[model samples]
Target: MAETSEARASASAPGGDAGGEDDKHDERMLECNICLDTARDAVVSMCGHLFCWPCLHQWLETRPSRQVCPVCKAAISRDKVIPLYGRGNTKQEDPRNKVPPRPAGQRTEPENTSGFPGFGFGEGFHMSFGIGAFPFGVFTSTFNFGDPRPSAAPRGTAQYDEEQFLSKIFLWVAILFVLWLIFA
Candidate 1:
């Protein structure tokens, strides 16, 4: 279970998905709206949203006076929320497997801001409420962003040379394929 959580965290990290931007949509669909991580104990809101049960429950609990869907502000409640069960579970599984994991507690942000302005981390106004998720994810991947990736190797390095060579080889293969199509 710890291994699965660790894998999910790393997959959600900057430069994690090796397949590039195409995988973004796939990943985004399964992520919890509040936690902004892969959905564990996943549930779908009636308004058509994906969220982790704990995150959704915490959000709903925090705003009891206004029990609406976190993603779409539609009507929602503890009873209204449906739990998702994975087909991976087998009838012959271990005893520990029968019990569900405990819910994750919500983190309340401090009043004082540090990294970016206008983003009220204090008011539970996360950047991933839908719009800012792309830019935030992209900027944070590199360019002085929080989770900075390591710098590329210098020009004379063998690693750099190998990468360039591989790119050229792929380019030639692509060109040959295109030419074959044109001539055929």
Candidate 2:
């Protein structure tokens, strides 16, 4: 009897009814727009609307072309919504409510300042010579049309030494062939 009378008195007080109602409204505002429960993994849309990420993700997936905020009907998207973070709430309580994580921002590699791939000696008017003797070697390498130019191999490398050895052999062979033609 006494408890009921006190409760009634409190409800009828000057600051009573309005204070209770305002507190209720504030609590309700934190609820998710779709689930109607306290929001988890909350996200705000560009339209100033709040929602749970899972709920919003499903809503957008349901109507891909017509993604919009449930509260304001304003445009919304997974990439466009900003995630809400609360201190000390990093760990989610419910495992079943987990989402596949938010979309990541796009990135690109810096432009290559070096000349086109395999075009060595670092940028400027380039010149090349054919291997072997004049007319024959000119046809062998200079007019190789459609074939790629071999970049100069670095000194002290096995390839550089091998190339030098091959050049010497070819020079001796060309000399011998010319000498034989003159004698014949």
Residue-by-residue lDDT tens digits, candidate 2, 37-94: 7787888788877788888888887897787788888887777887777786777443
Q: What is the C-alpha RMSD of each candidate to the true structure, in Å?
A: 33.9, 11.4
Pairs with backbone N, CA or C atoms under 3 Å apart (clashes), candidate 1 = none
Model 2 lowest lDDT segment of ten: 119-128
- TM-scores, all models, native as reference: 0.38, 0.42
| Candidate 1 total steric clashes | 0
lDDT of 1 by residue, 99-180 (tens): 3543666898878855756433232222212234644543332222122225544568775676456546655655675578
Regions more than 4 Å wrong, model 2: 1-15, 91-98, 101-184
* Residue 140 displacement (Å), model 2: 40
**Model 1 vs. true fold: TM:** 0.38
State model 1's lDDT. 0.61
Please report, in order, the local distance difference test score of every candidate based on alpha carbons. Answer: 0.61, 0.67
Please state the error at residue 131 of candidate 1 in Å. Answer: 80
